[model samples]
Target: MASNDMIVAIAGGSGFIGAAIARRLAHAGHLVRILTRNPDRVRDRFDFPNVDLFRADVTDPSSLRIPLAGAHAIIDTVQFDGYPVENHRRGLTFERIDFGGTNALLDACDDQRIQRFIYVSGAAADAYSPHPGFRAKGNAERSIRNSGLPFTIFRPSLVYGPGDRVLTMFARILKLSPVFVMPGSGQQKLQPVLVNDLAQCVELALGGRGLNGSFEIGGPDPLTFDALIKLMMEVTKRHRAVVHAPAALMNITGAIAESLPHPIFSRDAATFVLADSLCDNSALLAEFGITLTPASIGLRYLAEGS
Candidate 1:
């Protein structure tokens, strides 16, 4: 259990990844402040002990001041709506939210009692990358590194667990469709980590000493996208014929998807599907001393109550 005196402020605590971290820290005896734009709507969602919801939007610099006041540490897991699909007209691009919002949060921490900064970045994050999401995450990482604050950045691979978007969506599709239409060649390799495991890493980082650096997080095994889909099928007990959609056609469909009020997919999303996200978990294991959960075992949640 962590010290009860510690107050951890999470910028995107209302979201999936942040909520898991918040719950983990709060349950471990830390006071968790969930910084969000809509506290009232999400108030009932976090009825757990030691959790407080504060209204704050990272996009709005002024709103962050009050919520981040006197925070012992800040964890950034802020991701914009319809993620991986940039709605530029609505100002939901990676630059504005991921990079810009992180900068705003760092600015707010200037006068505060902040001890550490933890950022949840992606495995493919690279400032020089052509992908917008990768570039934004890379830029955010660079800012955090140069902030002169003791920080631990986690570049997590594809994350899956309860309340996850990707795997859950795939499970839903498997249940309905006899043929599972996979994006691209279904050959892209991935190392998916459980959301709870990622939360555990954050908790460990907050407690451990001399653990200030970037860590690549992933599960025990690295498998192709098609293999992952098959594993999901085995777990969910839904066997469906897998059909690969050409990258070109998916790209076109994704481009069309971007025009929707709420895009479920985008051209970049297709590219993300085709990109390899493998990682070495040795560093994370050596530092955190955590035993990673395998996708085969962790994905059993899909089979429950079936």
Candidate 2:
């Protein structure tokens, strides 16, 4: 029930999650402004008639004002490049971008005529947690709650779909290797929601259905990490030996990976991987009326071009 003319601005709209939301809103006839640091580089990606690319970096407070001005709502989906790995030398830590950048956006909203504020927080967000990514998200959530604007925060559990890094990465591994090297015991449960369904949730939140509160969003089925990998194999028709690396070895590998210039997996990333990410979506269903996609059906997308 979103109006066609509402102006919605999305921070990090060039990213995986943000781009999906931008496409969904723009297709619904909303004027979508996509905020990114390098607009020209990503201009070709957004071919929608209603989508406009605005050059803005959440890390730089001064760059945000004009892009966010006069928007009805601002959805923040910004994450530092090489996520879950803190490139501190480049100022790409979770504290600087996720937490600090969100504060900057909130500060910029002072006179921008902004109404609702939506944040795409993670399932592992915890203010009290020692993990940098989790702590940053949890702190950002706190700031959004205290921002005094009617807000909606979504804590999505292991979002997966086309163009996603998580499941797609696993799929690539499954295609290449006879042995799938998994970290830890692979018993941790996950309920991964489809990226499109998450985009629809944002649309519903934009319509003022689920305002002034936080919601945990997830798919209907919760399965163990081992089961998820098996499902991926089933969909792709690639069966492989599942090898679980010991926690100590993973930690050592993560530590070594963190020192690399563009680290893909770190101790923090491993921590995230080993944890359970299940959530009850009754509230999300009640508010957004979303039909959650199961892993069995959604994983079929991996079979394409394989």
Candidate 3:
């Protein structure tokens, strides 16, 4: 318990993004505490000198106040995935973790006298989004805004890194396929933000109080969904059975894929991805003083993990 050093607590810190943020902060000589449901799972991950571990589920506020105690800052990396699966470490619905969890975390932070609160949110979430997933995150951001705490809301475009689900999925497919079947025309644009750069932004967000506002962050460039697949193929040195399935064909394929394991195309995933997911990274560069690595460079980091 180094009281002199800044003590930081992170919610959902064992996952991919959170792990990166925790590791980066820990390496920067910060006393890091990560709140997770399974301490055993993250024990080895956070075995670094400056990092600590706490077993606290976001769905349960009873244990939150204790872990957040004495922390100077809190970084919430919780990404509530709606996919139904056991051993997900969280059993609550997306609404429960996304909205309710923020309130509980904020209350705990306030109780702990936390100096800064940084929330990692997706770009799709906003003041107006018809999608339930986006709406939940929007509500959570609003909750943080109303909590009277110094908060910085980060709306990062599709984050991809070594262990990111997005890039790994494409890499796996590209390794196996000679041709890829993309949704509709595969012309939808997406800005894949690098995880390391995102983690750096989070670190910067914690260092000072100036970045205490909402900002959307993305990569240096936007690429089409099909273009990304080709890049993955190039990196993997594998050619894919490239197919640009028509929307009707994708609909039929999605129906069958949805019923199977690790489908190549899901209607929900396709809808969000095939639609434009763009954002201005200027806020991350100007306000946060962090410029994100390009997608091509970031993909290299991911492909190396394989």
Candidate 4:
């Protein structure tokens, strides 16, 4: 840990955005503790001298209090991977991890006297529905809001960078499927922000002296879902035929995919993608006193980082 530095703990710090935030804060001379379920899995990933890795699960509130006790700030970047988040004991859905786990984290936060809280929410969370993932995110936001903790809620558009699952998944599909499937005419507007920009927002929130509020952030330019796919094709130089998946058919496919052990696409994801994920980042830009990086600029990092 750095000398006399404020402690900053990040959940899910092993992943793309989390790792980026951890590294950036560490560079800024803060003591960063990364909490994750699989400590060994991420052991060698982060080499920052100021970062400490600890094993923890968001589902268990008891496991969090110790780490969060004296932290100056905390970031919630927890994600429930795969389509179905099965809960044998309570038949819980993905919402359990989203809302339940977040509430648990908040409860742990309640035990501490932190100055700032940063919750990394998605752009689609603006109009969430009963869909497992969507509802879970919405519930998480509500839980944080209800917690009354001084916090910053960041709803970023599809985040992509060197080590992003979003772009990587699209790349995978493009490589596998000869006909790229886009949902609902692919006209839904999406503003894809860079992981660095989102992390910077978190950093700014932390430095803003408990400004404690919510902000919607997006990329430099708006692109339709189909246009995004086309851009992806252009970037990776893939010429796969683009296939537009009707919403009805996508629902069926998503259902079938959900039944599988690990389905790449969720029906809820398709539905959210059908809706506009574009957000105005003017507030975030003003607060940070910096211009947001373009998603396309991050794509260069993806090419090299991959």
Q: Please list the C-alpha lDDT of all candidates, in the order they appear.
A: 0.90, 0.90, 0.76, 0.77
Model 4 residue pairs with clashes: none
Q: For candidate 3, give the lDDT of residue 71.
A: 84
Q: For residues 1-306, write the lDDT of model 2, one tens digit per residue.
A: 245678999999999999999999999899999999999999999986899999999978999899888899999999888887788779999999999999999999999777689999988889998998899999999999998988999999999888888799899999999999987999999899999989999998888779897899988999899999998998999999999998888889999998988787788878877889888788888888879999888777899947
Error of 4 at 171 (Å): 2.3
Model 3 lDDT tens row, 58-138: 788898988888889888887555332111234444467777788889877755676788898878886477655577788
- In candidate 2, stretches whose alpha carbon ends up further than 4 angstroms from where it belongs are none
Model 4, residue 154: displacement in angstroms? 0.3
Model 1, range 1-306, lDDT digits (tens) per residue? 344568999999999999999999999999999998899988987988999899998899999988888888899999998888888878999999999999999999899877789999999999999999999999999999888888899999999888888888899999988999987888899999999999998988788632568899998999999999999999988999989999999999998998888787899988988899989888888888889999999998888734
Q: How many clashes in each candidate?
A: 0, 0, 9, 0
lDDT of 4 at 216: 85
Candidates 2 and 3 compared: the better one by lDDT is 2
How do all models score by TM-score? 0.96, 0.97, 0.87, 0.89
Q: Model 2: what TM-score? A: 0.97
lDDT score, candidate 2, position 36: 96
Clashing pairs in 1: none
Task: Write model 4 residue lDDT over 184-215, tens digit each, in one string.
Answer: 88888989988887877777777773276778
